[model samples]
Target: MDYKDLRKEYLKHRLDPASLHADPMIQFKLWFDEALQAKVDEPNAMVCASVSAEGKPSSRYVLLKELKEDQFIFFTNYHSRKGIELFETKFCSLVFYWRELERQIRIEGIAEKCSAAYSDEYFNSRPHGSKLSSIVSPQSSKIESKEYLESELKRISGMDASEIKRPEHWGGIGIRANYIEFWQGRQDRFHDRVCYTKTESGAWEISLLAP
Candidate 1:
């Protein structure tokens, strides 16, 4: 199969500033609502990108837990590579790709750890097994075998739910976006790219880019 032939057919939507909400967050909410209505699988999933102090880039899939006026929130282990990188540099990027809609959202921003109280609130809302897993696994760490993890999980499984707490190394990070770009696929590779950036005066300026 020719890899280049795997082109997207994007008759589903088009993005124009005139049709967009004045606030990017509002636009995001519109798209998110559409995704939900379409019943796309794992619609909350997004790609998070981080760069280390030494300039090494890493990215992974993470669930988008919340979206606030100025920031997007997700949880992670503070000691993980991405977490540590964000700690040091306080910057990251997130990408949401919904193939069913042939659309993507890219955001770049500064990251900061969310309040511990906020972490606890979300932690307590997780399933029992998920809470135990968060407490048991040292995320991104090298372990001996699956049995080691299973045993640890089993040990904690018997504990009372009230005894469970958010791990000290686990919490949430919120990315306050300085730039956001929305992409819509088009026929013959004539994709559309629209960008919104925050200016020094704390207002969003929108523009189009060649794609």
Candidate 2:
């Protein structure tokens, strides 16, 4: 199969600086709403990219659990590769690709761990099985086998839900985006890309880039 021939022509979905919300967060929410309306599976799932202090970059898929005024939130094990990278550099990027809508959103920013209280709240809200899994698995660590995980989970079967607490190594991270890019597909590969970057004055400046 010819890889180049696999490409599909894009349909124009133009975006302009004037048409965008002054607050990039609002714009992101609008796009996310559209994605939800389109019934995109796992709409909250996004690609999280982080670079180690030594400059090695890694990316993995994670779910976006919350979006606040100036930050995006997701949960993970603090000792995981991405978490360690964030701890070292505090910078990361998030990318959301909606293939059905032919749209993508990219954000770059500094990340910080959310408060312990917040982590506890979110953890308590998770399903019983998820809470048990979190308690049993040492994320990013080598496990003996699937049976080990199953056996560990079984041990917690009769535990009371209210007694389950957030693990010390697991929590949420919030990325405060200083740069955001919105991409829309167009015909003939003339895709539309708009970037919003925070200036020194703490205001955002929008610009268009050639695809």
In candidate 2, how many Å is residue 100 off? 1.6
TM-scores for every predicted model:
0.96, 0.96
lDDT of each: 0.90, 0.90
- The 10 consecutive residues of candidate 1 with the worst lDDT sum are 8-17
lDDT, model 1: 0.90
Candidate 2, lDDT over the whole model: 0.90
Please give, for residues 1-211, the per-residue lDDT of candidate 2 as tens digits: 9887887877736766678998889999999999998988999999999999999999999999999777999999999888899989888999999987889999999999999999999998998888888888887788778898898789887888777888988999999999999999888988889999999998999889899
| Model 1: per-residue Cα lDDT over 12-105, one tens digit each | 7777768888788888899899999988899989999999998888999999999977899999999988889999988799999998888899
Indicate the TM-score of model 1.
0.96
Clashing residue pairs, candidate 1? none
Q: Give the poorly placed runs of model 2, Cα more than 4 Å off.
A: none
